[model samples]
Target: MTTRTLTPETSNTFTSTIGGYTVRGRAHSLSAWFVLSLRLMMGWAFAYSGLTKLLAAEPFSAGGYLTHVAAANGNPLAGTFAWMGSTPWFVEFANVAVLWGELFIGLGLLVGAFVRLAAFFGAFMMLMFYFGNWSIEHGVINGDFAYMLVFLAVAAFGAGRILGLDTYIENYEVGGRTLVERYPALEYVLG
Candidate 1:
């Protein structure tokens, strides 16, 4: 068997190149398109989830979802609301967070408003879901964690600025001009 290694010249930067070609950098159109696609997909996912949870539609019982999470923690809505398995107050809080978080994330992505921030919330909610389920089997495997990982790409890349609301926000004449002009995350996302 032969081994091929992919290495970066400068570890400080997120840039990567190959044989005088920019394997991941300097491609504006490509990057923007990728970000746009991700935003839409993630948005729809959240919207669907929020609608179901908020409406308690068929197959989506807020109570059932809460019970599932609680069960993972070895307790079932029989203990404390805040404690994976107790009070109704905790259940209510989680439901609200999940519902709103999803709706906002979906809407924001579609309109490209605070896209990265919305993605952040989506990721956080996904993490909660992943952890709750994992706890059920004591670190056992679950697929939901993979879905949560999708946001990692969005947040780390911060692609919304590419043909996104950031294009305008980046140039806004606000108190802080440095952040707008620099476009820090551009390097990683662009590459």
Candidate 2:
């Protein structure tokens, strides 16, 4: 996949507020809209996936997979999937893993509640998606993965001043230092 560079910070799109920030401070423009758009898109994407999976578990489940499906598609993960098939129960677990992850990602982004946590999980989930497509020659991937990552980074920076709960969540004694805040790339979620 081609790499895309982030635009340098400019304009008032990305803004922030201080003093437990209930929209109490100023922020940037492009950055703020970027966050808003990211949150909305990420939420919808996962909501669509989660809803589909909820509607049909069979196709996504291992047993429903055609034998050598990945190999048929020329993906190297075929071997990994074969190995995983050894545990009869694993497919169910995998399905559950993706379902819950997408569900929460959708919920968090849509509601703007615990958005950082949601973005963290959303980014992590996309990493898994990235790995999934890595084995193919000239592989294809979701066009939105990078956008999701940016949304995550913005949440890392906290966009609650305009429409997020992160604003109020940043001030508690433990709030700024919470686990989500301490994650190396995610501290801004608490800021």
Candidate 3:
């Protein structure tokens, strides 16, 4: 996660062009191929999950899933799940959020559009899933933990800069000032 000035002789650097405006930046140790692979893997996993759920019976219903959580024996969060299930509005909202959130995050990651932002939200959603799905019957650490870590890694490493649209957007200039230069705080999400 080092930022070095783009030099003509810089190795491992990438050049991006949009609307005849070309910009160059150092891709650093993160190889474009590697990031693309991770993007596809993580993106497909999420997208597939959402698609299957959408195609499944009662795609928008959280009742069955929440009821299962509530009925699961020895689940510490059973009461909370039951309460959530009792409220139709909350369950409906959660159902829609989960459905669209997964779809958007997956597409964003795959296309390398708004990658850092997507990873941030992806990590947040994963955290929620981890907590909500926690069960005594299953081990404490699960795939959600691994997925969350991957999302965080993608965000921290600026994986989108290698092979994604972010590479161009990151260096996009308006009035001779790039977004990152204009707003230093945007470095976190823009990267």
Candidate 4:
């Protein structure tokens, strides 16, 4: 990644009010590099996790984890998780969804295609994990929560536009109009 020297024109300054408090922040042009780094890092991490599970000698199964691990430890969603685990069809669906969902989300982020969609789903998975792990010893906040926030930030910042395929895809001519222009709803999924 290349870092660009920050100039007055390149710097982004903004102000917002939340909960009756005024907030102000400035982002250096180099912030794009950091966002891109985050995208790549998360993409690699998720991809590696899914790939390892796929390659494992034993078939991936969430039944035991959901029924025992997730239901235990005072989890607020214990009943729901246990029910899902006990349901044979739901367990089967979860196994496939978890394995393939991670792989697809990772690939989408890595290639910067449909980044918003990927980040949305990634955040959702992390949210599920945050509740599933259910560790409050240190605090309610944990790695899963942090990762969920990062995923949200990635989508909010439109990180895929930073030297990503989304830029080209967004501009590709479709029936004489750019894809984004042709289908406005695509903005929700693409960068």
User: Where in model 2 is the C-alpha error above 4 Å?
Assistant: 1-28, 56-69, 134-148, 160-162, 172-191
Each candidate structure's count of clashing pairs: 6, 14, 0, 0
Candidate 4 segments exceeding 4 Å error: 1-11, 14-24
User: What is each predicted model's overall lDDT from 0 to 1?
Assistant: 0.62, 0.62, 0.78, 0.90
What TM-score does structure 1 among the candidates reach? 0.63
lDDT of 3 by residue, 69-171 (tens): 5456565777887877778898898899888888888888887878888899899988766766775455677887778998987886687775778878878
Clashing pairs in 4: none
Scored against the true structure, residue 68 in model 4 reaches a CA lDDT of 89
Highest-TM-score candidate: 4
- lDDT for predicted candidate 3 compared with the true structure: 0.78
- Top candidate (lDDT): 4
Cα-based TM-score, every candidate: 0.63, 0.61, 0.74, 0.90
lDDT at position 25, candidate 1: 39
List runs of model 1 lying over 4 Å from the truth.
Answer: 1-13, 16-29, 55-61, 69-82, 135-142, 175-191
lDDT of 1 by residue, 1-191 (tens): 37656445432235656788664434443565776687778878888767766677443325565555555466443243235334577666666676787887877766666766777777787777665554546344455566677776776666576556755665566555644446666433321
Model 4 weakest 10-residue run by lDDT: 6-15
- Compute the lDDT for candidate 1: 0.62
> Regarding TM-score, does 2 or 3 come out ahead?
3
- Candidate 1, residue 46: how far the Cα is off, in Å: 0.6
The TM-score measured for candidate 3 stands at 0.74
